[model samples]
Target: MGHSLKKSGLRQTRYGSGSFSSTYKFALLISLSRLAIEKGQDSCEGLALEYTDIAEKFIELYWKQAVPYTFNDEGQLILNQNNDKQAEIVNQIIKLRKIYSSLELLRRDSEEWLTLLKEVECTVKKMPVRYLQNINGQNFEFLYPLDQCGKQLILLPQVMYCLRQFSEIIEELCQKRWIDYIRKNSTNAPILNQLPNLEQFMFEPSRNQLNAVASVLVELQECKCFYCNKKMRKGSYAVDHFIPWSLYPSDTGHNFVLADSSCNSKKSNLLASDEFLQKWQERNEEQDLVIVDRISVLGFLTDKERSHKVAEWAYTHAKENNYQVWQG
Candidate 1:
């Protein structure tokens, strides 16, 4: 997915497609197999790395099978997998991985192969975290934030894809008693919190990211309330997430919008009072033109009032519009 790190211009790096490296694609397959034996399911990436042998094998297979390709059809665009040279490399890697996996379980490994595999595995493990950390630590805050340890990076689309994939994997694993797998790597259990759960299996935009998106919505919606088309006047219009934070804390960004306080609050969490919903339905889903007094919309409401209602409206609106909603 988008999160897969790729080298960009001027030695700049970008998130990967979440695809395994050619030499290491089989590593994922082997890792899954090992995990199934231990926990009866595929293990999370972090959890899988706890076993050096499994991790090594996986990386080896990925590099071996990950041969890039080319298309002789001479298409307008030559995809990476279609590039002739790369494809050959990838095919070779794939073949090697298969051969290695098919070996008898009790067979002894060749000394050269074992040594090379260990080196490859360690290098793969160390390189990514280091690269991501370096990028994040760099003062250059271009469009994306990179982790100092190179272990974390974000790509809007890649992050989305990973979330979907992770969700799918977690759901599949749920069919088995995967909880018992935790015992195999107790030292890493604390990190589980960092892993996404089924309910929150997506990245939540940060305050800055949310704000950036909100600003875009303001401009795109022409500084008017999206629901009512009411012209926004003075001060910043509130941006709210379409999905209420209360119900879905994980979903955020570009999906938010600008709205007058009354319409905004009524649309809180994309829901409102029964009476409001009735009126909304009556208006053919148009936001009610009759809004709360301008005084209230202009921050005249009490802190408590805003905290309970207006704040929710603001936060949700910000999120829906993809503005960075500051938590503080």
Candidate 2:
């Protein structure tokens, strides 16, 4: 059943098959999968998601890419997201990025933020939401019914379950395809063909943002390594993903930990041991408010329960597959 669902879900992503003109389809699919994990449950029940919520996800997904991607310290250019013109959302976000240094700052200005969200919501509903399920000129309503939903997108029963179950695979596929779309776009291919680490630039949180987060973590963790409990000198510690980004790419506030360089390097891309997991959970519970207040300002999403849910999903997948766990 899992294999079947994976196949079906993957097929939906390739609906138009190499004819994508814009990245909206990829963005919408990713938003749905992440929302399934963050908002839906493990059950086979249908989930109703507001178009506004999905619009916010689209903004988050495109926000980083809207900035100029620097190459070789010589030049910077924003990758064109459409064949003929920059994506409307990307263009809008690029303008906003000029005014606001980070996503959180834009979010804080409720007036401007609401205006953007409303615009994005209209676009999402009118564009990808209308076309994502169309396969080879036929409407394939595997995800949701197009006619029934008005203000909210309702995930068909078991669609939510499959999205949650296969989120990692789905996310990776979406990202790879999104990257391919950028690389193949006639305007981008000339310059982006040789760029390395394009995936990191497209998805990962910026180093500057992470550095700002590290400052808050340094104070919160009392200057000790999160894993070893060792006191670390200033300027030597790194902000480590308590849940590695390779496992789950999204950055949530409580999933960060201050680790010394050694531990951070040694534990790269591996889930921490169960003991550390417990400690991390305890730390989050204790510092939930502090993390939300501090880190959200730095442009990271911060919800302790949501972070814990993602952790639960990650750890379960790890244990089932006997994934290597870092012991510190």
Candidate 3:
């Protein structure tokens, strides 16, 4: 019975207040967009009561962006609570967690979050929404997306925009928390890196890096996956970090490799096992000749040593921290 959102329904400039960025608001929009698309058939009926638990999705988003790993000498990455023990980092995480745990992402019976949720919700709900009410004490039924809402033309642009916004925020916060944590503790460190945010590249890659990973990496590797040495094609390949970008923020020619999509996704942001690392090293050495031209064209990094130091730093961290390198 709620009134439909109007073109000017948005009130808050963004989600979260004050110091917090619009990350949560944007992420929820992306999540909501996904939920709607997934349940389009029923939702388009304008009465399916398409339900979702926004809180859960927000938590998952938090972990995917914030999770950091410490490695043991065997060259593997593992979770280390101690790494997040610093009072400042711990406080940041605590604050961030409170933001997640107390998210007004979904409308609740409590009047406080409901208004915030409504204001945020209108940013994406252009079409008529029948209603929104809690069902099982936790889950919320977003109920009904008019025909216009289901159209890809309307939906796709919003989805991509939300996703790009989501990725930028994730990239910023991930670097702020985890990378900063590593830097403070590792003054004498060899090579610590930030995990490659695969989403960022796929969706909104840096203006400074190889904008064409499939073609460039294919040429570099002779159309072979850098990890498995398997043949690849434009659509079949995944661009991966030779040194996980979760460990290193830099994305340049020397650090990139083409891999089977399955292999790259499996690796996620984990450090590669010794075998793969050695292979990566060899590939890096071989690509040094053409690196300048390729990277310079993109105007990213021309220094091959930056990539080398990153690799060295990553391996040394794995060696020192006893992190378990990802094997699969």
Cα-based lDDT for every prediction: 0.35, 0.87, 0.45
Model 3 segments more than 4 A misplaced? 1-204, 207-211
Over 4 Å off, model 1: 1-203, 234-236, 243-254, 271-328
Q: Is candidate 1 or candidate 3 better by lDDT?
A: 3
The digit string of per-residue lDDT tens for model 2 on 122-144 reads 99998899988776678767889
What's the TM-score of each model vs. the native? 0.25, 0.93, 0.39
**Candidate 3 global lDDT:** 0.45
Ranking by lDDT: 2, 3, 1
**Best candidate per TM-score, number?**
2
RMSD per model, one decimal: 22.0, 2.0, 19.6
Error of 1 at 106 (Å): 43
- For every model in order, what is the number of clashing pairs? 66, 0, 25
1-328 per-residue lDDT for model 1 (tens digits): 3133212211231122222122122223224333332222221322212334444434322342232221234422211332113334334445554555422111234664555455544554554322422433443322124343233222222332233233323223321212223212233234442443412111233355445445555665678776667788745466665435543232212235556676766666544433433332343223222222211122111122212332343334445556533221
